[model samples]
Target: MTGRNSGATRRTPAENAQLALLLEVAGTPKPGNVDRRRDLEDLRFEHFLAGTVGAGKGLRRAEHGARVGIAFERAVAGMSRQSGGNTQFGCLLLLVPLVSAAARGDLTPDGLDRVVADTTVEDAVSFYRAFEHVDVAVRDPPAEMDDLDVRRGEAAAPTLRERGLTLSDVLALSTGDAAGGGMEEEARGETDGEPGAETEAGTRGIPDWNAVDWTTGFERPFAVAASIRDDTGPIGDRTARAFLEVLADRPDTLVATSHGPAVARDVSERAADVRGDLEAADALADALVEEGINPGTTADTVAAGLFVALERGLSV
Candidate 1:
């Protein structure tokens, strides 16, 4: 049921509904500690659910498309913080829907946004590519990126803020205005420490720490889902879905993948293969591959491999 191998075939109604849920959840903002790993798992599940229920039997294609956009936007928003507002994350976000649409032969990412929000194709591409490693998503800027790249990301930060294009905005764009706006408000309140936001957290009614904690060790979920979504080679839909399910069912796999890069980074500084010190670079690519996080038709498998090497301090 994975879109990668389905040749962009229509999704089942349940899959569409689940996609809606994933978009909603991912777009909603949370603290810095929010678990992306779990967020991705939910998304994968939604995809699976949609297929299980049958398309047209439940959710319409348009409804599914809208929700898909929302899910992507949310992932971008949630991950943008770590992406350091770089094109890597932004590009990843922007590219998902376009890629998905193109793959399905139904929509182009740029065309949909242009029609829905009056955005230009160039702007949409720029916004998505903004996730480049030097952007805002990084917890700490990488040493390898040129100062100009770093500045570029910083400069773009204001546009994202002004446009209210948090990670959720990426998802909302697909879901529609109402869903996107509501999620943005939630993210804003959470970031600002608003009353309902604070009180609702850890309480029964709203999304809170409990929600975060319930989806513990999200790294594997993200890695696996990203890998499946981003996969573009010979893999089949069933294999891709199985990959994600494995990650969701066993959270440790995500952590394990994360660990490989993390450990590699720590041990490789100043080594002959200096390129390997770029853990974030490698980690991001690997996670993207593992989770199929790209928005374009082509998967950056080469980049993912490079990043894996970088994470491990290995010479490619």
Candidate 2:
């Protein structure tokens, strides 16, 4: 709690984005996720710290206006430099755009909307390339989407360009009900300069709810940030609380992929049960780790929320 900041000088957007990553992992009792007080057998607290440090270059890149996909790819590659296989892939996914918006001196939904609206085919290419650098835990894309499967990584670049897909276009394709797009619909700058105008794609692939952030003005992180700011206590407590709140609100995609969707639902129910009590959360944290259940995406959202909260000047 005492170490949330350095000197009194105001930090840059990139600096706050990086610190958000650290503060997220530093928070304790975030059930089923790695935190300062707990660790899984393979991934550890130190690994997250290392991943954050490694991701510094790309965070700066986003601040300097690198394309969203390119900056995200750079961040993932840098984050993989440590022994941890993919410690912060999702966190970086959520941070890049926020950092970019903050750099423009507008850390609001409107600012993020403008940045994502400018995504290009090249940005989509680098985004696919980013998946190659880490073993991200993603479910296989639906059989029909074989050509666009992220697992294809850079190999799908040609296809992406052929379809004129932007990074926003791809993410829009991942949202719930995936209710958007024609064969060549320009998702970039659509819907009054926002991404993901629902079209033909059905909610087919069991949408990566975590990715909804990219399409809907990053609504979840923004909501969680407000939750954190409105609460009282150490930053760690606020983060932990926000994590639980997010988990309770929805089934985590990673959890659904690892376990079953039913298990993911049960986990969310468990989170709902313990969210208001840090002591109960600590107890639940121990049980969840022992059970090998990790709500990874919710943790990522919490990190994203921390970034937004920091950008909004939530006191440490």
Candidate 3:
């Protein structure tokens, strides 16, 4: 039941989730993301490993109505204590609900939506608390809504409390303008603190939190899952291709925040350009890193997708 031989043995959903997170960071040639051979000055492979291990218990507790936000806070806190940095903030955000749903033994798309929809206001507060514990960079809130700024961290908690905004409500606001303004643009001018925008509650909406795969019934993650499900190669190849699929499909929000929308779109186009050739994709990865463009959100989606693949018993 140990080592590679353990693949044939059954693993709990939590174990599968943790392994998926590890596989994600370990996936090489990920293009601008930290991998086994690549490390940021402030983040490293060991840090992500630590974060995944640190978050294990919290992920196991996902069922029984454990608030995802609280689980996320505890997971990030543990990771910070171990690594002194925010190595897996986005991954944790995406994994918690998925892990929770998996724990319920019904991680179907509908089940995931239910788990997300069930999040409460306290969950939203705890999610904000997680931000205070890490130095994760996110886009600004709409210009008019100072209170909704994620950078405000715990300072915005009082208003969140006052407005009784549940985690879903907060996610809805963050999901940005339904007309395709993108999360980065929704808070651009603000509207005197009014709600940002809304979706049909069933249709696809732009994701505000890059790692929040559960927001839209795990749409992006499921898409990645679909791509890799048929692969029988090493887990790394599956992961790498899934990353490309996510990048090619959309501009990464983290890249957009760090660079700009134009740069993000350019990166997406480059990924699309290289999608058919592994060597070209590797070249693109090197170029992206050279230019300091990290498609981190896309990486998070890959991790979530890998989790789904594993949970569904897709051969790694």
Best by TM-score: 2
lDDT of each: 0.28, 0.76, 0.69
Candidate 2 structure quality by residue, lDDT tens digits, 1-316: 0122235756877888889999999988988888998877778888889889999999999999888888989998898898857788878888999888888776777878888899999998998898788765554455677788787888998899999999888888777433222111100001111112221232233346656788788888989988998999999988888888988988776666555566777888999999879999999999988887787788788889998887777766
lDDT of 3 by residue, 1-316 (tens): 1111135666776788788889998887788887887776556788788878887777776644477888877777776666436667777777788878777766777878887888887887887777777666555444677776766767778888998987777777666533112332111111112222322231133354443455678787877877788865778877887788788888776666655566667788888987746678888877877776777778878888888887766654
How displaced is residue 154 in candidate 2, in Å? 0.5
Query: Compared with the true structure, what per-residue lDDT tens digits does model 1 show for residues 70-170?
Result: 33434444433331122122223222433333334433223334333433333333434433422221111123322212224335445554555533343
Question: Residue 65 deviation, candidate 2, in Å?
Answer: 1.2
Task: Report model 2's TM-score to 2 decimal places.
Answer: 0.88
Name the regions of candidate 2 deviating beyond 4 angstroms.
1-7, 177-206
Query: 1 or 2: which has the higher TM-score?
Result: 2
lDDT against true structure, model 2: 0.76
Task: Give all TM-scores, in the order shown.
Answer: 0.25, 0.88, 0.85
Candidate 2 colliding pairs, count:
5
By lDDT, highest first, what's the ranking? 2, 3, 1
On a 0 to 100 scale, what is the lDDT of residue 199 in model 3? 23
